[model samples]
Target: MFKFLHISLLLFGAVFATCARAESVLFLNPGSTQEAFWVSYSQFMQAAARDLGIDLRILYAQRQPEVTLAQARLALQGGDRPDYLVFVNEQYVAPQILRMASDSGVKLFIVNSALTPNQQALVADRADRVGSLVPNDEEGGYLMMKELIRLHPPVAPGKSIDLLAFSGLKITPAAQLREKGMQRALAEHPQVRLRQLVYGGWTQQRAYEQAKQLLVRYPDVSLVWAANDEMAFGAMRAVSEVGKEPGKDVLFSAVNTSPEALQAMVDGRLSALLGGHFTLGGWALVELHDHARGVDLNQYGGRDRQIPLLQLIDREYARRMLAMGATPDYGVHFRKLSAKGRPVSYRYPFNLQTLMR
Candidate 1:
């Protein structure tokens, strides 16, 4: 009757509306919003998603691996399953999340975190993992060492130049790779002596405490190396309190140039930095969009998703890159996608050497 037709029409309209709703993406960010690096990355990803006409939902893990795993699981188990997921691999949970995504059929992409060989093997045959976008961390680490040695060359033959390092969390692969590069660089420089390597847990406060202890223990420390800018600043603070001038009496260098770090570099408080990894998140969104649209860039070629490091030696380059941040104009690389959202090749448009210029 007329009543039945009215109910049928209403149901059909509801189903149609649900079907027409825009696809959404869920991002699991590793750090708290309080940190500049994580905040910048999250903002960039959101901006890119908006520009690409995709809805984005972000969850912060506050640097806790357990929290990251739980948040991802909760999001996936909820009634509203996102069409795509973007996450960085947290310690001990990368495989679990990957398996979950694969089984749930959610398209997944990793950004900012490198996969281990075992993880790579596990994901090699999986269809859900579109690919990863990680920085060439080894080169980044090598560049950091190169810059440090270039600015502050070896001391006289009788005198030894002692260097201390504040490393990131032990569980992360990026940290491991960067450490590897540092080792490689250190091997070539016999004039420099690595006094100690301390775990800073990738935070300013932790680095501050550790640097304080180390400075008292090794008063003759000639240089400090840190895995990230936050830790570098902390180490710098410690060095300054003890009447040592960074970049003068003592030299310091770190990875990832925050605005503050760059300013310090300009002022001669910090020597150099290796960055350009922060853009990976925004670029990953573009790749995810393409993947959802049936255009797999990885299918076409080799190592297209791996990003490289950009070494910022002076103030000018740092200022420009910070200003560029995660805005739409910064993602010129993604503009090459066709109307169907496929690129001609898998090569990314950015690199360390090119960006440094």
Candidate 2:
């Protein structure tokens, strides 16, 4: 009986030790919970956290820079400091939070958006800044434009294809990178001409208003490219109001996988859609989980990892995705994707295909 009791006690001790080693992560979401993109991003991360046995907490910043900084300050200075803090450089507010996190001894990871070159210089020597995992926004932009141009080739051999673009806030790195991508695609295709590029502030109403006037100003423009789905929808609305068909008369392209955008594509309204970046948060968690287990992330990728997270969603792809349901079933084994589960030479291929498989 005494021997049996000893074995049971040892098993209990092992279970307790395993529970004690579980890591906690705090994510300061830069967007409000109401925002579909951010909500989906958090949901995928939660799924990953559950699979990896991580304790995850999220705080919404309502897309305000001041609120983001305030939340970071409270989380960093208060008791129950998390083992890691994940955040984005929205509106360039991450520098302040990075300093607070460094002082508080919390490791930091940036997602969605990365630090500016200047900010990178400031934190280049900080060991606590684990790394950044961002989508290839430039590639996303390039693909959007390239697809839009393909869908609507020049009307004639000599006639140039007139284009108009709607970009998000100019300050954000994602927007700037996307714009660069659009420019790169434009450079490659000499037959396409950019009539005007305007900032939509990432809002449907703003893009709608801009589109109304731009369509009149540049009546010959047939290709419209937006940095996000919301702006693309807005542009589509304006095109309809101006008595022009969106998908046929004027082709439109956007980035994001919102249900509305996918449905629009299925219905033959949206021309081109690039999406799947919403999985970044979940992929980031996989990296953090691996790191917590003493695996070096640098071996898989450098300190700043920019992977191709976006894919051009075609009409059939959109239909299939909608059939799956509103929320995507990541169906991914977080453990297998980690460093411990993968081979020594395995490179992380975190993309839509991974989730789908």
Candidate 3:
């Protein structure tokens, strides 16, 4: 009787441990289903969640702030509240979500778009706020502009390289950071005269229309810098409509790893493309998985981890990426990227090289 009772207790403990290992993560995607960048981002994250044995749920906000808030409220208030919530600071709506999640006891992790310093102050005391994983947007912006300037050297000695810039919404933190980086690069190169900087609203149509008007307004603009791929493509179209060659007459540079952008790079239409930050959501999953398994996330990079995930996708690299196709097989051993059982010195391989490997 004593032996049987001991065995039953052991089985109960084993079951409890298994249950503890299971965790659910809710991802609030800030883009529509048809949006290429966000769709790819969620796909990569789903692959990671599968490998880590995490139950991941995604809710799209269709790029609307009100929809995002509404979906978040529904998810949080539902009887089946997720154990963790991963979100982006899209259009400056993170604070409200953070407060809602904190009140409901759901651990929060911000990805892609991180909170500003002032926004962080609002939830500084919330221990349930896990951390943030964001790319160095400013670095990405600065690099894209620097390359554009390099590719389009002045026609004459001391000639101003006229440029037209397309930025996203000013209220978005990511857009603000990217613009800040562009400004830094512009400041360094005094001859690169920015004729005008207009908000493209992150849509190809709006960017196309804006480009049409801006191109005519600034005909001497030899350089065009867009904050994203869609806007870049729009600007390219506008350049072509205006009887100027895209890659030849007016050089273009932008961010994001959409297949269209990669193919454009291959075709020599896009002068520069910086990307690979879509893996942020996947990397965040790895961190959360390790944290759930008793790994101290603080040892890696503390609460707010800003990683240099963006890299310049040259022609050769662009070809390699394109070969992988639209829904590229991530083929990543997500567990290998975790810090759960690794040494203290083990660094997380969170870059394009990892994806290529």
Among all candidates shown, the one with the greatest TM-score: 2
Candidates sorted by TM-score, best first: 2, 3, 1
CA lDDT, candidate 1, residue 72 = 79
lDDT of 1 by residue, 134-213 (tens): 88888878878878888886577778778999889888888887888888999998788898998898899999999999
The per-candidate count of clashes, in order, stands at: 0, 0, 0
What are the lDDT figures for the candidates, one per model? 0.76, 0.87, 0.88
Worst 10 residues of 1 by lDDT: 333-342
Badly placed stretches (over 4 Å) of model 2 are: 1-14, 326-329
| Model 3 C-alpha lDDT versus the unseen true structure | 0.88
Clashing residue pairs for model 3: none
TM-scores, each model vs. reference = 0.87, 0.94, 0.93
Better of 1 and 3 by TM-score: 3
Cα lDDT of model 2 by residue, 101-156, tens digit: 76797899999898888987876568888888999899999999999988885567
RMSD (CA, Å), candidate 3 to true, equals 3.2
RMSD of 1: 4.9
Stretches of candidate 1 off by over 4 Å are 1-22, 122-124, 299-304, 322-346, 351-357
> Sorted on lDDT, highest at the top, how do the candidates line up?
3, 2, 1
* CA shift of 13, model 3, Å: 12
**Model 3 CA deviation exceeding 4 Å by range:** 1-20, 326-328
